[model samples]
Target: MSLLFCEVISAQQSLPKIHKDEVDFVNPLIGTAITGFAKGLDGGGTMPCVNVPFAMTNFVAQTGESKMGRMCYQYEDKAVIGLLATHQPTVWMGDYGYVSIMPQTGSLRVLPKERRLTYDHKDEIAKPYYYSVKLKADAKTSIKAEIAGANTCGMFRFTFPAAEKAHLIIQGINLNPELTDWANDYKSRLKRLKGYVHIDTVNNEITGYNPDRQSAQLGPELKNFKGYFIIKFDKQIRKYGTWDNKIIKKGSEEQFGTRMGAFISFKTLANTQIKVAVATSFISLDQARSNLKKEIPDWDFEKIVKDTRNNWQQQLKVAQVNGVTNEQKTIFYTALFHTLLFPRQFSEYGRYYSAFDDKIHNGESYNDYSLWDTFRALHPLLILTQPERINGMVKSLLQMYQEGGWMPMWPNPTYTNIMISTHADAVVADAYVKGFRGYSTKLAYDAMHKDAFEAPDGDMQKKWGDRDLWTSYEARGGLTYYHKLGFVPVDKVRESVSRTIEYGIDDYCVAQVAKSLGKTEDYNELMKWSANYKNVYNPATGFMAPKNVNGQWSAKPDSGFTEGTKWTYTFGAMQDIPGMISLMGGEKPFADKLKHNFNDGHYRADNEPGHHYIYLFNYCGMPWKAQELVRQHTGWQNFRNAPIGINGNDDCGQTSAWYIFSTMGFYPVTPASGLYSIGAPQFPYIALNLQNGNKLVIKAIDLSAQNKYVKEVRFDGQLIKNHIISHEQISHGGTLEFKMTSVPQKD
Candidate 1:
């Protein structure tokens, strides 16, 4: 080896060093850019937002009109429209109750196109709790905008040149009179989403409300659902006006209707700084004002930044990260930051407006449950990093069941019922199995059990698109057929093959919960129902193939899946891998099939369906294959420290969750099973500080690119033969040591 290679190897063999100030390693911009797929690299589908962990609202620089399938801020975008307070969970989810604020100089520009201010990436700073940029309003005028975010409020500091017509525009998303389309495209700006605005010149404030949610068409008509915002300024408003579309009524104090907005104009000295704090609420206008007064009591932008940063520091510090290069550290912590941004806290000040019941109630609540995507890995990660909040999250789900009459598949505040099957069962079951309680297990089991047998409103022979009109709760799309025929029929259901397999996985989770509650009959029946996955398996193709209502396999065996293909779902029945392996002919054949799938470029690490596919090798006894693949994924290839880092939609943190788990050397391949599949640890040493005063340390001796596979695994100094560890072992705390070697440990 050359001298450089020798030095690198020596460094990798050195003792792992403890890393501090991990918050500084977070790069919010990692998944913000949409790039790389065409160039044979990972593409991203996430926005760079400034917010606290699980914050109700996210504050971000708005580049253009963005929501569900579009990013608000793209790295390629050359201008900034405004600073938006958004509740968009992911690129695949719609934003609800959103608004924006912008600083303007000279003539006022209120519309998104007119208000566009140019900015360069080099002049910007983006972090979880903070964002700042210098926007050129004119050739000679550059407005410096800095932002700090809290759970429900956002603080802004805008520095301006000596301009007499300096203005602050408070705007509402114009999406009320929306087009009845998936894109949420508005036909005309003249007749847009109805909004309300009030300019309090005496108090130097502006208040507004927007009652538009793009996901509303998929849920109950919420009577009192709207975002109420209270903006407090630390300066006097000399002149003010409200605007509706292109009609700018000067000196107007209040306005309510299409495309509503209010602007306050005043003279400013050279380099004069104006600070504004804004808080939002779903309860009422009074609550919005209260949130503003309570969360941000004064105009201390720096203090808020410092406190929020410190809050993030504590959260990021929970994992005592070590080993790897600084680049890996950035990717690691940034993924952590992404994972904690969803299942957002919807409750405000101990009270919340329930979108399901369409009323305000006193209790803890969390919205945007993205259960289908998150239950796979995100919630599993939360069980470790956010143990204290688990009860509240479960209670929130119970509240949804109580109020809505059913447990939603994907609760975007209410039920979008977006994804297939009921993975919410997996989340609840996994939590309970991992020793979490407080919510009634009886009710939890009932809710999950109901989904296994109970059919939805439209029953079967219905093409329930991913996001259809919310006419009724779609608990289990083809449950009627799956319950009777042991499989969902392709002729009856749109995504028959995928649903059959996923429903099987969900049923297995419900069975575990039932077994824990001592309901043997229910356990046996659910367990039997869980094996319904066999009905869809085509031994001829060695794939989970679609079958027609006539009990015959479809000609196109690979069709009818959700966001994936046959190669993705064939081994996706993670709940009963032994059964899957048996069906696939045997252990050797199963392992060969897995290798075939990976070698053929059919395994998509970019999506959730194939997320657990990487761990299937452990079952068939080729864990070194899993170890190698895990390293390639957790390393720089899939998870990058750049704008186009992640291969696809972070899916509200599932992508990041996979990285954290796989890198830490364990993955909850089958949630609710209470067992984590072992993968190769990229980090030499990782200290996980559990909430219950337990410290789990993961050590990888001599881990490097060269030492790529695990020679042997030991937990608490005992050798692990099966390449698996239980939740109890991890939660109770102990050391998990993996001896590394350059050669694959096929044995």
Candidate 2:
């Protein structure tokens, strides 16, 4: 190694570090650039608003147009309109809510169908705690924003020359799962808002005039809006228009021009700001105030913004990386930021309404359960860094069982009836194995058993398990087809591979949970379920190849893995890699084959399968190989712009989080599993301040291009020969020393 490399490695041996809270590393624009097979920008609905992750008052409207891409927004004819509380599945999948306060200017009207407003993408600005956009108009009006926890506040400082009329309009445009007719008693639902609002004075006032504003029924044309929530304003800072007195929910006869601010009359020295605050579950006005007070307790907007950014920075610090290019850092960390954005905690002030029971309860509430997507990687990352939150999440899930009457695989408040497999079983199992507390293993195991014994919807598919559980229509038609024939049919193709992998992962979680609970019989039974992977793996092709009912592999090579080929699923042996090694014949061949797979670019580093597998080498006695792979991968995966820069779908942040962990020289490959498999370190040194008030210090000795492999290893202060580190050791928090060398240590 060169002198500089020696210097870096030497420094690594004696490096100092600090906790995540000490760092200032919040950057929300990381994965904002859209890339991969998915379309649309990499924009995200998550904001560095407040608290830890879910404590923000409200997230701004990520996009107003609905173009059906990563961040696509749908617009009516021309009007820039309302916010849905739901934003879709990141920038990859088209699903999400736009919550509270839609602002528009000029001729306000229902936006035309999915006509994405053309804005200068260059003018868009997103920061750790703020966002700004210049709308696509004749004279693009500029909009800037900040948020408290659940309430979003914006400053649309419009600039205008002498104009016939300059207008500002506020209208509630449409809702997803679109509403039909305005219930006369709609106020009952609207009245749910009552929370504390901490402001300078008591008068960060809300004016609810125009209650009877005229509605324009646009037929079944619009997706969901019984009647529009239209409010007209005539503040001294800007011109205002009267609410149209026409109530028509049938067709689009309303003129678009008259809808935007009636007209605009400009004054030269003109500037003004509007504060829009909205709460979703408006039970009473007091609840709204409480929500506001909890989120924004002070008048210092800048302080709140700074605090929010600082929150993101703290989480970003949990795992740090170096040596990669700046763009790589931006993309990796930004994507990490997005992964934690949603399933936001809708509960306010330690109390939240449970969708399961339809009753108000108390606890640290969290939502936006992207269980289907996040179960793969995001939750696993959380287990390593934010394990404390695991208990509360478990409790909340238990509460879901109490209220909703079953363990939810893809749980939200109202419904738990979606997705293919029981992955929460995996999440809970992973948590238990990692040694999380607060809830009982027995209870959790019971919930898991209930879920699996029951059908997809938590009801026993047969007479209380007297017979085999009837798989849900989707599962039966899809999974059973695979079980019978070994290959998924073509018609049920959208999520074929995902379904297969998920089934295996979920069953493995079930087995793990059972084992953890000491229910050996159940564990043995579930272990068989874990063997579900065999149903799909086609050894003839040396891949997790698809098969049909009669046990014939798909003639096509790309049948089993989702969004990837057989090369990816070849590593789907997450549940039992030792068995996989045995099947592959031995550690040497398995290691060699894996190196070849990744070297031939068989590894989908940007995809979900691309995650957590490098560390598999450690289990096979090839830690050096795992380290080299990690070092090589982190060195090259650099995309710095918005969505366009990231590899594959951000999957929230799992993909990037994988890179982050791998570069740090270790990863929690299997969720809820306490062991962190070591990988190669890119940084000279890194550290993590464990929640238990200790530190995880990793020093790469003699680490460099020429000295990347470990010649020796030590734990605490004792020398060791293997790569695996126990959860107990990590939790106790001490130095982990890796003495590096060019060649593997002498056996």
lDDT of each: 0.84, 0.51
- Alpha-carbon runs more than 4 Å astray in model 1: 1-20, 39-42, 176-182, 185-193
Q: Model 1: per-residue lDDT, tens digit, 385-479?
A: 98989998888888888888887787767888688988888889999999989899888987887887688887864767677766787888888
How big is the RMSD of model 2? 8.1
Which residue window of length 10 is worst by lDDT in model 2? 211-220
TM agreement with the true structure for every prediction: 0.96, 0.75
Over all chains combined, what TM-score does candidate 1 have? 0.96
lDDT of 2 by residue, 1-747 (tens): 333344344554434465333223345544444434344323232322223454323444445433223243311123334333333434322322222344443443333232223455465555545655555544534433333332322222233333343333333222222222331122322332111111111242322211111111100011221111111122332332323223322212122211121221233322344444343332234554555455555445556567666776777677656443334345556656665665555555667756455567777666546565566567766766777777877776767767667655443333423444666777777777777877876788877786554433322222111112123222222544444444344333434554555666666677776776677987776666556666665555556665543455557657544556767777775777787787777888888878888888677666666576788888787777776677666653433344344555556565666666766677776655567776666656667767767778888876676877777778888876567777778778888888877886535
